[model samples]
Target: MDVVRRNNVTVTGNPDGPVVVLAHGFGCDQNMWRLTVPALAPDHRVVLFDYVGSGRAEPSAFSEERYASLDGYAQDVVEVCQALDLRDAVFVGHSVSAMIGVLAADAAPERIGALVMVAPSPRYIDDDAYRGGFTASDIDELLESLESNYLGWSAAMAPVIMGNADRPELGEELENSFCATDPEMARVFARTTFLSDSRDDLKKVRVPTLVLECNDDVIAPREVGAFVHDAIAGSTLVTLEATGHCPHLSAPAATNAAITEFLAALR
Candidate 1:
């Protein structure tokens, strides 16, 4: 299959500028990065794509077995980079896509040089000395609820994940995005996202990295942000004044500024 067609890849921005890939999180498509695209387009070649089973990606390309682990998503990133022949591209990944970027960079070091991890959490379930903000049973219950009724789970969880109750539209948009996804595919992605642990991957990131986190994200708390920063040597962590996991949607200006600043420093 043509990787671009399979992933619904969309490229924009300055043709002569450095390449920057914007990857969305679970239950989200490339549209989620609409607010941030213009900011980078002025000075960077921006690439956007929807993972299979999400957004307008070819549904037939989705395989539950392939997507049962985060490696599958990383493969999607690697293949997209190869299709574009991207060299040392800057990968900006949101939510679960952040870890996927880490994996992709490790898998194809020449394709990606730097990383911008937005609202990332290496592990969601808490362990002995770590606080991932959720217990094992919590994840189990959440997954069980989602498996039972994905739509209802989306409607109820989107608002919480968005974290801007004052602006209900953001939550509604996320809920709609979730609803638009194939439930069975979403379930697989959800299980894969919530159950996986990528803490060990942090130490392997040798490229320049910026870890962006929200001031109040229910999904990825401050502790997780600190852990990520401390784990990755020579990484910069910026706490946006935003209050949601999806800061690109909730606080685009701040998020874009931080990202653009990071890009500038690299040059």
Candidate 2:
């Protein structure tokens, strides 16, 4: 299958500029990055794509077995980079995609040079001395509720995940994005996202990295941000004044500024 068509890859901006790939999180498509695209387009080659099971990606390309682990998503990133022949591209990943970027960068180090993680959490379930903002039972219940009724779970959780209750539309948009996804696929993605642990993977990131986190994100708390920063050597962590897991959507201006500043430093 053509990787571009399979992933619904979209490329734009200055072709000669350094490449920057924008990856969205679970339940979100490339459209989620609409607010941030323009900011980078003038100076970077921007690449956007939907994962096999999300957005407008070819549904037939989705395999539960293949996507059962984060490696599958990392493969998608690697293949997309290969298809574009991108060299030393900077990867900007949101939510779960941040860890996926880590895996992809490790898998294909030559293809990715730097990383920008937006509202990332290496683990969602708390362990001793580490607070990932959720307990094992909490995750189990969340997943069970989602498996039972994905739509209802989405409607209830989207608001909490997006935060910014003052902006009902953002929550509604997230809910719609969740609803648009295939329930079975979303369930698999959800399980893979919440249950997986990537703390050990952080040590593999040798490139320049910028970790962006929200001031108040229910999904990934400040402790999680500090954890990621401390885990990765020589990484910069910026706490946006935003109050949501999806800061690129809730606070695009701040998110974009931080990302652009990071990109400038990279260049």
TM-score of each: 0.99, 0.99
Cα displacement (Å) at residue 91, model 2: 0.3
Stretches > 4 Å off in candidate 1: none
Per-residue error at 84 for model 2, in Å?
A: 0.7
Q: Each model's C-alpha lDDT?
A: 0.97, 0.97
Could you list the CA RMSD of all candidates, in the order they appear? 0.5, 0.4
Give per-residue lDDT, candidate 2, residue 191. Answer: 93
> Model 1: clashing residue pairs?
none
TM-score of 2: 0.99
lDDT of 1 by residue, 28-67 (tens): 9999999999999989999999999899999999999999
